[model samples]
Target: MEALTTMKKKKTRLVVRKGNENIALKVEDIAFIYRDNTIIVAVDKEEKKYLCDRNLSALEEELDESMFFRANRKYLVNIQYIRGFKSFEKVKLEVSLLIPTCNHSIIISQETAPLFKKWINEE
Candidate 1:
C-alpha cells in the first residue's frame, strides 16, 4: 500500500518575546531551527528564539514555501541561504547550506525528497 502524506507550502511566522518586547520572524531568513526542551530554537540572521507551543508538524504549515524546508526531524533549513545540495549519498541527499555557524551537511529525509526538489526548482 502507498504511504499517506500531507504536504503544505506556506511561510512560517514566529512570535518571539524577549522580556516585554514581541517580534515577528519570518521562516525565510531562518538558518536552522532546533528544539530546546520547551522552546523551539530558530536561528535567523539575528540570534533569537521564537516562542511557539506547536510541534514540528504544525509549525511546518505555518512556514513559508520558498523560504523554509523540513530537512530531517531536527532541522528546518532556509532555501534562500542554502548554497546548494550535495550528492554524496546513495539513498538520501547530502544537504549542504550556508547558515550562521558554518557550511555543513544536513540530512534530507527520504520521505521529504520530492518536496525539497520542488522547492529548489522554484524560482
Candidate 2:
C-alpha cells in the first residue's frame, strides 16, 4: 500500500495556451479550472485565464487532490485560492476565489457539499 501510494505522482506544471503561445505554468499558481463553451480554461492567481487543451475531467486526474477540488461540473478550484464560501439555495454552497478577474462564483451541489467542507477543513 505504501509503495502504491508513493507511486502516485503530482503534476508540477502544465502547458497551457494563451492566445497563440503556449506557456508552461506551475501547478501551484493555478487558482482554478473551468469549462467555458467548448473550451477548457485555467485561471491563475494573477487573474490571467489560459486555454487548456485538456478538459476539466482530464485536468482533474492530473491535479493534486490535496490542492484542488471539483466544486461542480464546471469548476475545479485550488484550495489555497479559495477566499470563502456561503450557503446558498438551502443545501448548496457558493464559493468565492481570490482571483480578481475571475469574478464568477463556483457552486457545490448538496450531495458534494459535505465532502467539500471536509476537504477544506482537512489541511
Candidate 3:
C-alpha cells in the first residue's frame, strides 16, 4: 500500500523553459511530452509548448504511469489527451490525440499494442 501510494504521488508542477524564462507548469495541464531532436518538449492542453531539461526516460519515471503512456520512442502521452487509436499498416496502432501533435503520428508497434490496450482500458 505504501509503495502504491508513493508511485501514485507524482510531481504536481514541472519546471519548463520558454526561451530565457523558466516557468512552473501544472502537470495536469500537460497534454504530452516529446523528444524534439536533442531537446525535450512538453505541450499543454492549450497547445502551448515548453522545453524540458529532463529527457523522455527520466520524465517517464517521474510521472504517474496511470496518467501517462509511452506512446512511442518520441512521445509520452497523457491519457486525458488521447482521443482514440486505430490500426496502422495492419501491424501497428496509430494514436490520435485531442490536441494535434507536432505534425507527426503516434504509433505503437505490434509488440507493444497489447500493453497499450490494457493501459487504456484500465480503471
Candidate 4:
C-alpha cells in the first residue's frame, strides 16, 4: 500500500501553442504563472517568461488545476513552488513559496478555501 503511494507521485502537463508550434510544458519545470493586471505570464527555465494572450481565469482553465492554485485574485501559482502556509489570522493564511516570488505572501481566506480546494482536486 505504501509502495503504491510512493510510486504514484502526481505531475502536471500543459499544452501550449507557441509560434505555430505546439509545445508541452511540464509543471515541475515551471517556476510560476502570474497575472499582470489582465495579462498572464509563464516563467520557466533560464528565467524566460512567456506571455499568454489570455487572462488569468482563461489560462487557469487550460491548466491542470491540481498543480496550479489561484492564491490571489491576480496570481495562479504552481504547488511545486508552494513552500508552506502560515495561518496569518483567524480566517486568513500566508502562503510561503519555494521560488523567489516577487509578489510575496498570499492570503488564503475562508471565502477562498473552497475554490482553492477545488483547484487542488483537479488534474
Alpha-carbon error at 12 in model 1, in Å? 6.6
lDDT per residue (tens digit) for residues 6-108 in model 2: 6687788999999899999999999988998998998888888999999888888888998999889899999989988999998999998887667787899
lDDT of 4 by residue, 1-123 (tens): 999875555436565455666567776677667777666777764445666666777666666667777777867777766676756677776777666644545677788876765665565
Tens-digit lDDT string for candidate 1 (1-123)? 223323443545677555577767765656767665666666676645555556776676677656677887767777777778765466677676665566445778677777788888998
User: Which lDDT value does model 1 have at 28?
Assistant: 62
lDDT, ranked from best to worst: 3, 2, 1, 4
The numbered model that scores best in lDDT is: 3
lDDT of each: 0.67, 0.90, 0.91, 0.67
What residue runs in model 2 are displaced by over 4 Å at the alpha carbon?
1-7
What RMSD does each model have against the real structure?
6.3, 2.0, 2.2, 7.2
For candidate 3, the 10 contiguous residues with the lowest summed lDDT are 96-105
TM-score of each candidate structure, all chains considered together: 0.69, 0.91, 0.90, 0.63
Task: Sort all candidates by TM-score, best to worst.
Answer: 2, 3, 1, 4
RMSD of 1: 6.3
Report the lDDT tens digits of candidate 3 across residue range 1-123: 999988767788899999999999998899999998998999999999999999999899888899899988899999998899999999999998898554658899999899999999997
What's model 3's TM-score? Answer: 0.90
